[model samples]
Target: MVNITVPQNSPSSSSHYKSSPEGLPSPSPPATIKPSGSGLVKDYWIRSTTCTASSTADPKRKRQLKVDIPVVSYGHSGWLTSSSLTTVVEDPWKEVEVDGDGFSVYCKKGARDVMEDRFKSFVDFNGQHKQAFFGVFDGHGGSKAAEFAAENLYKNILTEVEKMGEVNIIKAIKQGYMNTDSQFLDLNNRGGSCCLTAIIRDRNLVVSNAGDCRAVVSNGGTAMPLTSDHRPSRQDEKQRIESLGGYVDYSRGVPRVLGLLAVSRGIGDQSLKQWITAEPESNFFKIVPEFEFLIMASDGLWDKVSNQEAIDLARSFCVGNDKLQPALACKKLVELSVSRGSVDDASVMIVQLGQFC
Candidate 1:
């Protein structure tokens, strides 16, 4: 299991949601599955592989670009089974320890769906290699999906990376996202979640994302988006959904697929399975010398704050006094988003790439 710094929810995380006894569906597993300490991994081996799109030069027009992001087959409705109890984290802001300058993470519960956003950060050890993993999940209807992904997604990524012998890191990240989604779906979960994950290995930073939760890096004082947001209203996403026989409708002044979920890609959502997917878009880059810091958050923060604004605020605070304080930066950003009016569940993480002082 990945060692993640989970955010302790406010008063609502425990009281607002249904318990595992109430949430767990039919076909409950045998008593033997639950051991003395080990949780869900004892009996289950999750499997998943997400698709990747590539950009190639057009045959006829040499300068033109051709994109190809493949999609894996999905037919695992039979695997749907039971889910574990809900996971909770205390404290809204704190420092998650890591080896040699690890990043800082901060989160704030929103008004919708029992503080649906969740995150995880840790170094992987159960694999052939060691890599730092950080993920942020935004749940739409409930916290179950987000919680499950946070607990199990990093492990799956480590598994896939080991399976491939680390030949292709991008493929492994994609597969990790899909595999986690599969595990959540198998539990017969109701809500879907937007996910953004960043993996650091040997000074390389790889970002993978499904749905709108995002990652932004400070490159030479400019906010550079590592993963693009996948909202249903986007032309490409709308076209893809329409091709799948799914239509996008406007409600509450926001475009949604079939007038339902706002994001086009995510985990769970059995009803929107045909259109919404777990496939993730990945970006690969080295943690160059120009890299200053990284800010990752849900749409609640992005909706109110731009990439530059967030970078400026965090950088200014990181170097304000005697020493760097990424934790403080994350806290300030979350507060700013709320002050600017973000009604959704707000979550933010600041990764200090290098010391500014």
Candidate 2:
């Protein structure tokens, strides 16, 4: 009989998910067959070609002629079954505010998600500046890179702005980006990249794009791109890549470098570190009250969904619900992207007036 003993801490110990009853008897093993008498006798006999009459007469050879045979037995056992109960903890979403912009930011990391691509609304500088800043740092590679930008970019911008003053917001933005990149390189040994777009003092929207992630601004019910998507196919990007000793190849009529990655700009990627540097091209826009909303999303959502589709969806939710919040609208966009078969990590942030407070 086969006797199987399970440890107390085994998976089957859980009463809720276990299949077997308590203290059940083990199952029996398969029976083995014994050889017949003649076959067993033949198995012990030895036959050798070199045996001679003179050798047979030797006492040692005669004494050792009786061979001892060993019998081995084996049996089969049934399969063992077990069960386990797993407990998963869900993360919570929270709302954060940025002073008096009448805007509130709500952020949540979704199911099986690791990256957080949210932002804090701009804070005033020494209580003297009237500018309200808001930004979305879309991260690629990992959340650490994005988190690094989201936490430090604004502070870096503020510091650069203090030295350069209002005359050089673009320059300051660039300098701040470089500073942040250097800091990331120092801390992580590798850095992550981000697409940064900030609304400063509620009057200017400054954007710095590095990767394929995008920032779009909705104006008067029309979608307008606030920043260009930095892809490897772009002429300037291709030239920059090759200039930095990287090669671009055409595979199956599609232009690709190393036949895999698509983006032109990113942090880390130390393998392509020569091609990647932290010099950001800054574009500044004068914000008017006419600006309806700003939508920022990772490539996962943008790759599968159109800009207009996202805008329409967000607008629909905003118009239908009298008290619709922009952050909630952003969440809805993420949900829609998932429903549309976007298997990649998806994140979206929407900024609109009157709903942020």
Candidate 3:
């Protein structure tokens, strides 16, 4: 028997609606029997030979680009399941650790063959001091949506800000999200990304989230969650999807939309566009002395680590030190999540709020 455990609502998290349990239809599994776990050496040999022969047969096709980064075997392993075999190949382009002017970021791939998580940070955006944009995007299905958003979401937001000015920051942000979503759909890309973004301008803090990615701020040693996870299990989100002619399914361990996508809101997912919206929940705050630092991460870390637990650990690494080491702190959080059995790609960023204040 499979006992699926869902994340409990946190005190710092807010939801406008309550959930009522009900039965739902489960989708039929694929008829193909996928290879499970590490397979027989013979099977790998057969597949390799077949691929080599096929490539040789089609010599006119362009060769795939070869990456030259050295592979580190440590912490990277392949796992096997009853229905499929998963491998983890280290990506050299991914930012394992980075230290910016006032922020630090860390990322690590999980058991998946490709790391679907992406992040972006721009300090002194638009050539202005104390103005910045930070984001963590968790991609599902593929990395295209995540990559596109990481590169263009802030740009779109900046464009909107330029048109609307400071007074309409919230409206500008909402428009920015919709514009990004529409632009991505126009590209005819598949998959989707859940994202959390924080913008600092004129000493004011604006935070937004469209999926499970989260933003938490440390206020005088207390952990404050600024964004709520937009899962299908969430009452308001489930109801919203149903009202729009979408149904939430409970099969496959967790509540999912049509038993396919897990999150109810995201940037792309053109196929599920009708059911999934890119509307992000946003909040505003005035930077104050009480606010110490901010933490933004994908659901990968949140799935295994609690907001308070992460904040407590970060405080030990970032606060009261002769020199700040937020990059190391971010790494530690990702490591902690992995140790706690998180198999999802984790990306974490820590921003020192006091610097902006």
What C-alpha RMSD separates each model from the true structure? 16.6, 28.9, 13.1
Task: Write the residue-wise lDDT of candidate 2 on 182-279 in tens digits.
Answer: 78777744335555555445465666666655666666666666766565566887898888788666544445444434555655444455666667
User: lDDT winner among the candidates?
Assistant: 3
lDDT by residue (140-258, candidate 3, tens digit) is 76667787888688879888988999789889888999999999999987678898899998878999989888888887888888887888888989999999989988654567787
lDDT of 1 by residue, 1-357 (tens): 112121111111111112221243332111111112242223322122221111244557644332322212112232323322221222211212111234565666655334566777654323213456678888766666777887778778878887886668789878988998888888887777889888777677788889888788877887777877787767889999999999988756667778767788988877788998899988777788778888878887777777788889998866546766676788788889788766666778776655321
Alpha-carbon lDDT, every model: 0.64, 0.50, 0.70
Worst 10-residue stretch by lDDT in candidate 1?
27-36
Q: lDDT value for candidate 3?
A: 0.70
TM-scores vs. true structure, each candidate: 0.71, 0.64, 0.76
Backbone clashes (count) for model 2: 9
Q: Indicate the residue-level lDDT of 285 in model 2.
A: 71
How far off is residue 252 in model 2, in Å?
Answer: 11
Model 1 segments beyond 4 Å from truth? 1-101, 124-130, 319-321, 355-357
